[model samples]
Target: MAAAFLSRPVYPGLALVPQARRHIFALEGAGAGALTDLAPDAGALTRSDILYLPRDPDGAAQAVALAALGAASLWQAPDLAALLSRLAGLLDGARMGTRLYAAGSEGFIGQVLVVAEAAGIDPLSVATEHRGNRARRVQCVHCKTVAEEVTTQPCACPGCGLTLFVRDHYSRRLGAFQGVCIDAEEPGSAPAAEEAFR
Candidate 1:
């Protein structure tokens, strides 16, 4: 009976994440010094300049040691619209050698990546540490709607009223998984909704 609540025709193989190798500065959110395999001096990372998600101070702990170092900490619970406005000013005059480090919820890292990428910062120079719930950002191809923190597989599109089956494929351009109509073959036919995507 539990399966009755879950979506039918589950695309177990459809969820394909991007293949790009990311530079993992921290996965445990333990900060820079505690990063295994790599040990960068706080002074060096500071003098070279850095940006971090302020909510996960584990990485920021070392950056705080140097008072005169150029370090920018993003608020833990920041308003992306507002934070991006401020990040723009910083990126406008961003000099070479400045590194970006983010350690927080997946949403935060993903959103910050959008800004950093827009600023022309290479992904190689940035590090991301994902924390918190394992959710995803999904965008509907039909209506061009973005769904945030989605925790289900086959779900209804909040924008166009279409049932979408999320693919594992991730698009860097859209910053979300591609959600296509799973019942497109039969038009109105669809599987049961999953109580939770996780």
Candidate 2:
């Protein structure tokens, strides 16, 4: 997954901010990371340097580090609203078309994209893992027809009298941006339909 590292300015003599305690708790619970402690060398930090540390061992560590540095804030959303807000602020003075890596789930990526679109920021990539459940199409035994794609649904054939069973299916819904693309091609080629348009 892609991890974004934000660099915030560290003011002289200011202590490490202790806000977001609840958020940190949630992060730790999620197996992500928490804002445990500041990087040891706080005095060594300059306006150009800040340090954030993650307490857990997941992709979220990088984000925590940035947050500790005061470069970015972590927004916890049932979806993506909070994340977008933090991303926009972090990218305030960044150049147009600057590539960013956001690591989360599919839903998380979607939320960030929604925010990016609203703020006129074009994200270069989104990173996630295959941890959640997904929909799959199975063949029905009764009807000999393919069962409709359903989430956590039993495979009951749509065709004649047959009952199909469910099996472990590998879903590509939570990978990189290409997770949704049906046709597999080289890393950089547009989908066939898009290529046809060109």
Candidate 3:
């Protein structure tokens, strides 16, 4: 429980850093609303680049809305993988005064943080806000398989076939929560799986 509290990420929400020379936004699903709500000034929009991936049913509408915001460049990725790929390239070329902002689910934010870390961006300097479902990314401790969007406790490990107990101990490097086998001492005594993360 203490570990859970300690590891849980806090999102203070995204705001326009007025002093930044360039603004880079990484958005997924309902996360696009954060940027749209900011109502950035024309100068900021002219110096901003947005990479967005719509992950929900109303995603198309959101994409259209985001495109109309008139950022310097807006790329609508078809999927998360493509969005991340583009984000990597964008981060690689990011200038010194560029500010990174991400808004999405916790899992998506973690993935973004990982990318920024690799690009040598200080996590403290990146603005993050959580929006949308609470599904988590889980990494199996036994087989080291990282599962995406895990929504339940006692989730099955896709790699080692273990019934895992999802713990809140998160790894910034893995961008996932730790999942240890639930019944390792008594092989067949694991509790039933239940919806947890949503």
Candidate 1 residue-wise lDDT, 1-198, digit = tens? 433533221111111112322122212233333232233444433333333333343545643532233322323214446555556556667665545555444554556667778889864455655445556677899998998878876878889989999776666555677799999989878888774644
Q: Where does model 3 exceed 4 Å of error?
A: 1-4
What TM-score would candidate 3 get against the native? 0.95
Maximum-TM-score candidate: 3
Q: Relative to the true structure, how large is the alpha-carbon lDDT of every model?
A: 0.53, 0.33, 0.90
RMSD per candidate (Å) reads 9.3, 15.2, 1.5
**Residue by residue across 1-198, what tens digits does model 3's lDDT show?**
633487767789998999999999999999999998888989999999999988869799998999889999999888888988999999898788999999998889999999999999988788999889888899999999998889988899999899999987888888899999999999999988899876
- The predicted structure with the larger TM-score, 1 or 3, is 3
> How well does candidate 2 score on lDDT at residue 45?
29
Worst 10 residues of 2 by lDDT: 5-14
Backbone clashes under 3 angstroms, per model:
7, 9, 0
* Colliding residue pairs in candidate 3: none
Off by over 4 Å in 2: 1-80, 123-198
- How do the residues 66-179 of candidate 2 rate in per-residue lDDT, one tens digit apiece? 456443234433323443555666556555334433332233333444555555654333222212223344443333354433343233344652323343332222211211
Ranking by lDDT: 3, 1, 2
